[model samples]
Every structure is written in C-alpha cells, then in structure tokens.
Target: MKVDYIIVGLGLAGLAFSRELEKENKSFIVFENKSQHSSKVAGGMYNPIILKRFTPVWDAENQLKIAIPFYKNMELLLGNKYDYKVDVYRLFTSIEEQNNWFAACDNPTLSSYMVPKVITDKFNGIDALFGYGKVTHTGRIDTNKLIEDYHFYLEKSNKILYQDFEYNRIDFNENKIQYKNIETSKIVFCEGFGIKKNPFFKELPMQEAKGELITIHAPELDIDFVLKSSVFIMPLGNQLFKVGATFNWKDKTSIPSKEGKEELLTKLKSILNVPFEVVEHVAGIRPTVKDRRPLVGLHKEYKNIALLNGLGTRGVMIAPTVAKELYNHIENDMLLRNEISIKRFENN
Candidate 1:
C-alpha cells in the first residue's frame, strides 16, 4: 500500500503531527506499540509558568494559543471530553517566594498569566502559610483519554497499525520509503525515548530522565485546582488525586521503582497535610534534550526521515506548535528554528 507518511509512535507527538496531516488531507498510517507511558500516565497539565523560578516558560503565549484550540477541535471530532480549563495554585515555600511572585506579576511578560492577588484560601488540608499564586489560563488534557479516543478514531479510519515498528524493515530510496508491503513518500519518527533504538536517528543527543507518578485516594484533600509545591497534587475528581512526580536522571528504565514512590510520598506529604492511600504508581522516560528545547526537523542526510520529539516535561504545551512547525518544514520547505531543529546537534 502507498501513503504520504508513516508515523512511528502514537504519543502526544505523533497524535499532534497526525492532526496536521489530517488537516492537509494527507495520506498516512501510524504505528504504535503502546509501550510508552509518558503520554498516557502524564499529569497532562499545561501551565505557562516554570513554577520553580516563578517565570514564564519559553514561548508560553504562542504555544497556548495553538494548543488550546487544537485539542478543543479534537473534542469535537471524538465526541469525548478531555480538555479542561482549571486554575493552578502554586504554594509558596517561603515569604521570599511570595515577594518573587509579586515581582513576576509586575513583569510585562508574566502579567497576563499571573494572578495579581495571592490566594490564601483555596483549599483546606494543605499548608500554605505564605499563601499561593494563582496561574490563569491553565488546564489539562486527559492524555489517556485523548490517546485512546484518538487511536480509535484512527482505527475507524483504517489508519493505524497496532504493533512495534522494526526499523531494520524499512528500505529507504532516493525519494520514498518502503516497509514490509507499505510504501510512503516520507517517514516521521515520534517514538519518544524509544528513538534510542532507531539506528538512523540514535546519534542525536537524548538526555532522557525517568519520572514517576502516584495516584491516591485522598478524600480529605478534595480540590478543583492543581496544587503545586515541591510536588504537584492534581485533582482527578472522585476524591482521587494524581500526585507526582519524582524525576530521576540515573535510571532510564520504565519500571516503577520503590525509591521513586517513596520520594514522591515524601514530597507530597511536605505540602499536603492530609492522609491518603496510594492507589497506583506509574513511570516513564521523558525524551528530554540537553538544551531543554524540542527536537524537530528532517535528518541531514536522509531528507525523507524526520523527527518530532524532545518535548520533555511540557509535552502538552509544546507538541502542537512543534508539530505544526515540522509539517511546514516538510510540506512548505520552511526552515526550522535553530533552537528546535535537529541540525543543531549535527556536529556532535
């Protein structure tokens, strides 16, 4: 069979790219192994603030404007509710942090997202002595729901192959690619950390990190907004909260380690002054980069092979715009920005 593109992996990256192809009425097929947990088990929150330093994330406004409507349109396509507009309450660890919030609020770049007034009373069973900063225009996409429903949509259209893609099987020609019985004009890899196994693109630097999250039944800590401190306690409704996540750079395996769970509990307990029972624990490798920018663009030698990855911890905010960028680069011969283009690492 012949198609315009063959996408590997159906995580946020692949889904976002597929949407672009759908918009352009391009013929494509996607291969997903369902092995990566980063998207399905993600906290799925998209906030403009770094929270660690009370500064806006890079290109926050542009990404938000593109991602919000992109996912909302998906809601219309799938007839499932996954997009949510919720406020994020960032707890102040010290009085100095409170002052920093005010300083950030005064900055022109952050004024639009930073709530001027500090919220001292948003939820009970939480320790917020210095008060909290309310982040506006922030929310989450039920990533699990989005993945499952989007995959179903693709399957309904006969556009998905539910299997692990073997890189060795692909035969690259001058202007096309072939895999098994399939032929395509181009192939895009959105494999997340799994890209490490792809011989063609493994040379790119991928500073991956393992992250773990825990789900707990904390009836006493019922809240509407996401609570942020050392760890994020996001309400998943039904008296359940998804508190996570512990970042470990050493371990790259997907297995949920005991050390990770204990670390998360320690951090969660630091801010949440409520008792909770652990219900589940999940882990995945974030396909992060050294520069903390996304990895996008075509391979230097193989023009038909491309990549859309390195979304790191902010995949929900970064994927849509980056996907659009990749699509334009391929279909319109548009040059990718230096920071995000894979060519940045060509010498290394």
Candidate 2:
C-alpha cells in the first residue's frame, strides 16, 4: 500500500496531525495499539492560565486562537459536541492569593482570561473561605468522546490499522518508508509515553509522570463551573464531578494505585463538605519533559520521521498548535521555533 504518510499512535497529537493531512488531501494510514491513555483520561481543560502561579500559559493566546476554532471545526466534521465553555473558579486560600489573582488580571495578556472581580458568591458544598476568581474563555473538551468518535470515523474510512508498529520492520533506505508491504513518504510518531520504546527517537528525554483521577457522584454539590482548590472538581453533568489528579514521578504504570485514590480522597475532603460517592478511579502516564515544553520537530538523523509529544498537563490546549507547526515545518519547509523543536536538546 502506498500512502503519503504512516502515523504511529492516535492520541491528541496523532489525531491533530491526521486532521491536518486530511485538510491537504494527503493520504495516510495510522497504526495504533491503544498503549497510551493520557489523552483519553485527561482532565481536558484548555485553561490559558497557569493556575499554580497565576500567570498565562506558554503561547496561550495563539494556542487558543487556533485550538478553539480547530476543535469547533472537528465538532462540525465529526458531528459531536466535545467543547464545553465552562468557567474556572479558583478557590482562594488566603487574601494574598485573591490579591494575586486580581494582579494577574491586569496583565495585558492575561486580562482577557482572568476576571477583574473576585466573585463573592458562595457555592454550596465548596469550602471557599476567601471567595473565588473566575476565569473566562476556559473550558473542557470531552476528549474521551472526541477520541472514541474520531476512531470510529477513521475505522469507517479504513484509514486506521489496529495493531502495533514495529520499528525494526521499517525500511528507511528506499527513499520512502517501507513497512512490510506498505510504503510511505514519511512517518509521524505521536506515540505519547510509548515513544520511549522507539529505537530511532528514544534518545530524546521523556519524563513520564503518572497521573490519576477519580470520578465522584456528588448530588448535593450544585456548581456548574469548574472549582479549583486543593484539586479541580469539574462538573460532568447529572451531579457527577471529575476530580483529579495526582502526579507520581516514580510510577510508570497506568494502573490506578491505592495510594493514588487515597491521595485524591484526602484532597477531596479538604475542598468538599458535601456527601459524595466515588464512581471511578483511573490512571495514565503523562508525557512530560523537564523544561515542560512539548517535543516537536524532525529527528536529527532521519529527516522523514517527526515527533509530537511531551504535552504534559496541558495537552488539550497545546496539541493543535504543535501539530500544525510540525505539519507546516515538514510539508512547507518552514522554520521551527527553537523552544519546541527537538534540536533544542542538541548539546545535551
């Protein structure tokens, strides 16, 4: 089979790149073994602010500028509503934090997303003693539904192969990539944490952080917007909230641990005063890097192979932008920015 490209792995990065190919009428086949669960089990929030430090995310404005319309277009194409425009309410722990939020709101870039007013409105079952700061233009993408539906669409079109892509099987000397009977001009690896197993690209540093989330059915908690305190509790409709996530650096396994659940429960108690039932607990490893920027660009040795990974905790917001940059860089011979490009690690 002859195709323009063979994309390995079908997480957010893979899907975004596939969409770019489809837009340009490029034919490609995707190989996926469902090894990565980061995108599937992600919190899926596209907040522009770094909630931890009350600052804007890296390239937040441009990322959301492309991401919102990008996903909205996908919703139209896939016929599913995945984007939810939910405001994020940051629970203030102290008066200092509240002042900091107000100060962040004055930033020329952050002024758009951060609310100037501290919301004094009390929410039931939420222990916000110092009020909350509501952020605008922030929301959640039902990435689980988006991925599931997109896979169905790919399967229907016969564009996806449900199997492993062995690195040793690829023949790179033929001017084109050859894997068994298939031949392609290039290959893009969106393998998430699974990229560690890839021989050609495994030398790149990848710090996989295992994260866990719990779903709770809290009928009495009546807040529609996302509440961020000790942890973020997002509404999932029908009185269900998705609470998460604990970062464990040592655990490479995706299996939910007893320690993870207990950690979430402990944090959950600090934020909630209402009765709730734990519905589910899930875990996945996030493809993180030390510098926290995504890993993008072609391999130094293999020009035809590209990587899109290390989206970290902000995959929903970063994936679309990086995917476009990678696609443009590969297809149009465009110059890549130094920060996200894999070449930035050349000295190391």
Candidate 3:
C-alpha cells in the first residue's frame, strides 16, 4: 500500500505527470472518478496563435517544441495514433483583419506559424470573404481516445484506482502522506475544476468557464484544415465536423444548454452556408484562472501536496510541459517560473 506518489484525477495534467513518473521508474497510484469532461470532450486544437487577435500565444515556440514530441511519445507508448498535424485556416472578416494578419506575419516569433499568403475559399459553403490565413505547425489531438487508451493502459498496469478521492481521508506528514492504508512520499492534485471541492487547495482562485460543443454532419463541406471564425469548425473526418464552442463565464454547469446549441448554430450559419445536421451536443467546464496561466507547484502549507490545474482552453498544448515542470520541481527542487507557479497567489 506504499508508493512514491498518489495522484488524484487523470485528466491531461494527471496523465502527463504519470507518464513522467513511469519514465523515471517511480512507483505511483492514481485515483480517477471520471467526473470531468473538459479534457475528454475538448476540441483538441493545438495552435500557437491567438486567432482572435492574430498574435502569437505566450511562449509558443518553446511550448510547441516540448508539447509536440510529448504527445507523439504518448502515441508510441499507447500504440495509438491520436495526434494529427493539420493547418488552421483563419477566415478573415474584413480587409483590416487581413492587414493585421500581415502585421502578425512580420513578427519574427509568428513568422513561422503565420502564412502571409491568402488562401482562396475552396468550399462554396464557407464564407471566406477576404480569403484565409493558414497557420502552420498547428494540429488536433484525439483527446477522448487518448484519455480512454491511457486509462486502459494504466488499469492494465494496476496503477489506477477507479473512485472519487475524498479530501478528509488524507493524513499529511512532513515527508509523506497517508490515505487509508496507502502511504506515499507525496500527493499531487490534478483535479481540473473539481479542485474547487478540495478543501486543502480551494483557497486558490480558479475561475472556471463552461464550454459547449456540437458535432455536425456537413457532407458538402469537404475541407481538411481547421476553420476558425467566431467559432471553430474542425474536421473530424467521415463527413463529420466538430463545431463549437460557446464560452460562458456565469453558467458553469455541465448540462448542454439549449441556448448554447442555438448560439453555435447561429455562428456556424454566419460562416457556413451549407446545411448540416446536429449529431451531438456536449458540455464541460474548463479550469481557467484570472491571469490565464497554469497553476503548478507545491502547496504553501503542505510541502508534499502539489497542484497542477488551470489549463483553460489550451490544455492540449500546455499540459505536457507543465506536468514535466511540476515533476522536476518536486523531484529535483527545480524552480518553476513565477508566472506559472502557484506561489504568485501568495494569499492562498
């Protein structure tokens, strides 16, 4: 009943951390209740640009270097092909927007990912008015399948426990933690928005956002690239495209709202003239923080307790490196950057 680590939650964050532990040959046990769906039902797009403003995402180059290979390794380890390399076609709304894209391409940091050439609208249904700017080194991950496959792998290795983690069951010590009969050198919390219920780390501010997505059968819209406008229309093949998502800060419920579906359809119609059928609608809560950075580091009060949450809309690109940073910080006393480290929230 003893191990090197007891990890709670098995979302992208937990999975990435577990991979690191396994690579190091560290013994650990994971508790997952399958309560969250943000990572599970995510759009899984890994773009380095802020498409809304035509600017580079924070640390895009470095994050891409680490994230791409990390997921590739996961594909090899799990013996599944979930990582996809596809271009993101950013539809321009106006001449001004196209000019701004030109400006972004001039940036040395964005030059690699942003293509200066304007692509003609290949599909008649898409409203590519001023043409589109294709973003390179961008792709999508089949996160649902990745999570499912990784879970099965963990179960096969007897490293995972399928249950909810009760906060009260844990006993904290100077150098170890005990939960029931299980004792571990440390415990890490990767509980997504579920961290709100964790008493030990609830003090940290987690501004959770609710997102809704829909799958549509757009037979005529045969496109290979990810389409971005007010919302993203991603090609999932088999004449099915994943269209989503609507972000609502006030309503954090997991239920798929009628209004959410209507909003998505409204946006989809604005860009796509083709008729489509809604195949499915799903909803999930994203663990977002006010500053829009990940939360990683040891707990302020308990040294052995750590947290890895708040990945927000870009979990696919951020989780791998953040998890590795958290692991190194714990195992080697490495310093985590102030922007991402939980230490920035001193009051917590």
Clashes of each: 0, 0, 0
- Best lDDT goes to which candidate? 2
lDDT of 1 by residue, 213-311 (tens): 999998898589998888898888899889888889899899999999999988888877878999999999899998899999998888899999999
After TM-score superposition, the amount by which residue 186's alpha carbon in candidate 3 deviates from its true location, in angstroms, is 0.5
Clashes of 3: 0
TM-score of each: 0.98, 0.98, 0.98
CA lDDT, every model vs. true structure: 0.91, 0.92, 0.91
For residues 42-127, could you state the per-residue lDDT of candidate 3 as single tens digits?
99999999999987788777888999999999899989998989999999888898889999999998998888888875775786
Which rank order by TM-score, best down to worst?
A: 2, 3, 1
Q: For candidate 2, lDDT tens digit of each residue in 1-348?
A: 999999999999999999999999999999999888999999899998888889888998999999999999999999999999999999888989988988898899999888888798977898677899989899999999999999999999899999999999988965688889898999999999999999977888888799999999999998999988778999999999999999999999999999999999999998899999999999999999889999999988888888998898889999999999999999999988899999999788
lDDT of 2 at 304: 84
Worst 10 residues of 2 by lDDT: 170-179
